[model samples]
Target: MGNPVQRPLPDIEDPLYQAHFQGLKDQQLRVQQCDACGQLQWPPRDLCKQCHGDRFHWPVMPDQAVVYTYSVVYRAPHPWFKEHLPYAIVVAELENGLRLLGNAFGADVEKIQCGVRVKAHFQHDEDSGVCFLRWVPTTS
Candidate 1:
């Protein structure tokens, strides 16, 4: 892990998602929602999957979610994650009934379970200058 890129930065491949990154950059969690049918979606597509409409909106996500499913990665796929061996990649269901995926942020790696309740934590990376989201265990 010798100077092998300390962290991953946001990908600007699609302009539609720039608002998402910008939302995160400002410490607000945003998700894709339909302006037509009010359906929440992910991966930031051009059209709403439910209503088949092109009107999309990114609403600030709530602070809580339940772990839908998760997997621990022992072997660092990229060198940047080498220091964080056995980290968890989690998919959580939002209060609005949509699923989002991110690294389990502040929770103990050992106590991770399928139904664990977590609070969303947003932090700005000094290296990448980007705000990223992670999930931490919460009692309420």
Candidate 2:
């Protein structure tokens, strides 16, 4: 698992993930919650990985998370991310016990750290109807 030197191919959007995209536009961070076992998961899905449950719920996140790990990229393999090159990509543990992966926005390289508290920041792309959830350090 590494930042590749070439652009990863574009992915086909799954209709199942559209709900999650809409939730973000509503200013809510949505995660897949297992209707069977009550497990909250990111990367929206039609089935729960834990118990093979076909039902899931989209729950609003608590708006709080802690950085579990992070990586600072000095370069981006693709031009699309060039403006945000030298940024931080992080795995954050949400308050609801789900770990979410996203780019950490508004953070300085010298200030980023594991366990840093962050809050969800939403960006809407009307052209694509995509809502991205990035993170910004929260003031303690």
Candidate 3:
């Protein structure tokens, strides 16, 4: 059978963050930034976290980051992720001033190291209509 460990992705319906989810579906990573300070914010907020400014805009990501920390899941506590055991759950520090949390594929647990370069990819769930952000090692 197809990957049994696959799980439904998020189908966020709220208009405030619909565009954020759509960006992932389009294979373009985006995050909200303060128009004033240019600080990148995660989870796409309506107002800047730093200055509480309501002038926020979505900016495309450069897709370049380095792993800051990670955990190798040898066993998933839930049935949905069992097949993907031993996956690398990584927190990547983006160059544009953000740390994104996602799964890292195509790398072994022993090979995972802080400062490893990575780029973004997407995984979609047809049933639930959710898109997930995944990462792959960057050659550069």
**Ranked by TM-score, top first:** 1, 3, 2
Model 2 deviation from the true structure expressed as Cα RMSD, one decimal place: 5.3
Query: In candidate 1, which residue ranges exceed 4 Å CA deviation?
Result: 1-4, 105-107
TM-score winner between candidates 2 and 3 = 3
After superposing candidate 2 on the true structure, give the runs of residues whose Cα lies further than 4 Å from its correct spot.
Answer: 1-13
By TM-score, the best candidate is: 1
User: Which RMSD values do the candidates have, in order?
Assistant: 2.1, 5.3, 2.9
Q: Across residues 14-69, which tens digit of lDDT does each residue of candidate 1 receive?
A: 57888788887777778788898998888788888888899888889887899999
TM per candidate? 0.87, 0.81, 0.82
lDDT of each: 0.80, 0.75, 0.78
Query: How many residue pairs of model 3 clash at the backbone?
Result: 0
For every model shown, the clashing-pair count is 0, 0, 0
On residues 1-140, what C-alpha lDDT tens digit does candidate 3 reach at each position? Answer: 77655574555787667767888888888778788988778866777888888876777887778888888788787787776777888888898658888896554655778989988888877776778888777676
Ordering by lDDT: 1, 3, 2
